[model samples]
Target: MEDSTHTGALLVVGAGPGVGMAVARRFGGVPVGLIARDEVRLRAMTETLRLEGRTVASAAADASDPTALRAAIGRIIAELGGIDTACFSPLPPVATIKRAAATDAEDLLTALALVVGGAATTVRAVLPGMLARGSGRLLFTTGSGALHPSPERASPAVYTAAQTAYIDVLRRDLSGRGVAVAHVAVVGPVGADGHRPEDVADALHDLADEGGSTVLHLTEGAR
Candidate 1:
């Protein structure tokens, strides 16, 4: 829905070639705004989506930096109009995926900053508009680690747990306010069996249409 007063754009944070690209593509007519730490990837994806005939905007911002992330989002909103849906797809830092015994204070802080803090910053950046509009979607793509953790990856386990909890609380807080907060938990790598990135994108569309807080578990042969 295009409006001269509101942007109603889809903002994909951590817009990589995988789900991010697929999600943007699935939105079809809606303008898509993409954020990523890799400028080259951002530019390339923007171009690719444009070639595919989608109106798109790209900004480079690391997910862990709240200020940079917010600034990038602000630019996107300014350029595209407004964010109708915000999809957070970034994962915790690579260093945090080590053994439990190897985890440290810095690791914990980094994990929390990106997973929990980043999400908060991103959501806060757009919540005002969403609330004003009385309808919007906040979507998070997390690993199955959030629900069933692997002891080997201590940091992800911790980060995902916190991320899930924060989303859960947000969903409760926004209930009946006409905002939809949903989580998509992938049991394995995003592309499995017949489940392509476009399929995941389709799932996101379905969740937004449903307009409520819920989690969709993705696995092979389950699409």
Candidate 2:
């Protein structure tokens, strides 16, 4: 079911030490572009991948800033030639946990901007090209809290749920248009138990090749 043709750069937003690096490693030979907020870590990741003989480029941008994030994406496209596949995994460790009633408005908005608005902006940047070519892959890494909301993670749950809803609509809107929109929900610690980052990366590649939208749930016991 994997498409043999359609070679283009894989743009990974929120490229960090975990899912981002793992995905790039799984798709080793392809040209890769990484986007993250940390310039030092981004550079180091690029160099690490380059040492493996993988063609890689990196740019740093805050996901909450749409203008900057899109500009960074443009640089990646320019550096890697083109992008046909994109993976978004931007969640960071929660600094402060709050109940829904106690959460601040700005905090909720910030969460939405990073998780939902950020993805929208990135998609808007690359979608035209993909739609023109009639082929592309968009994958988002979602937290399990979205599916199973918890009072402890009230803020993230709200934004992530919104993100999931948005992806659902996007998949429907782009149906039969050759774009694959997928949501991969993380139910537990990414590398804990049998849920290897490598396996998650492999699944993402498979989804890209298949060219359809679907939800994939990964837990400790089930990959």
Best by lDDT: 1
Question: How would you encode candidate 1's per-residue C-alpha lDDT over 111-172 as one tens digit per residue?
Answer: 88988888999999999999998988898877766677777888888888899899889989
Per-residue lDDT over 185-223 for candidate 2, one digit per residue giving the tens place of the 0 to 100 score: 666667655467765676676676554444445543354
TM-score of 2: 0.90
Clashing pairs in 2: none
In Å, residue 80's CA in model 2 sits off its true spot by: 1.5
Model 2 RMSD to the real structure? 2.6
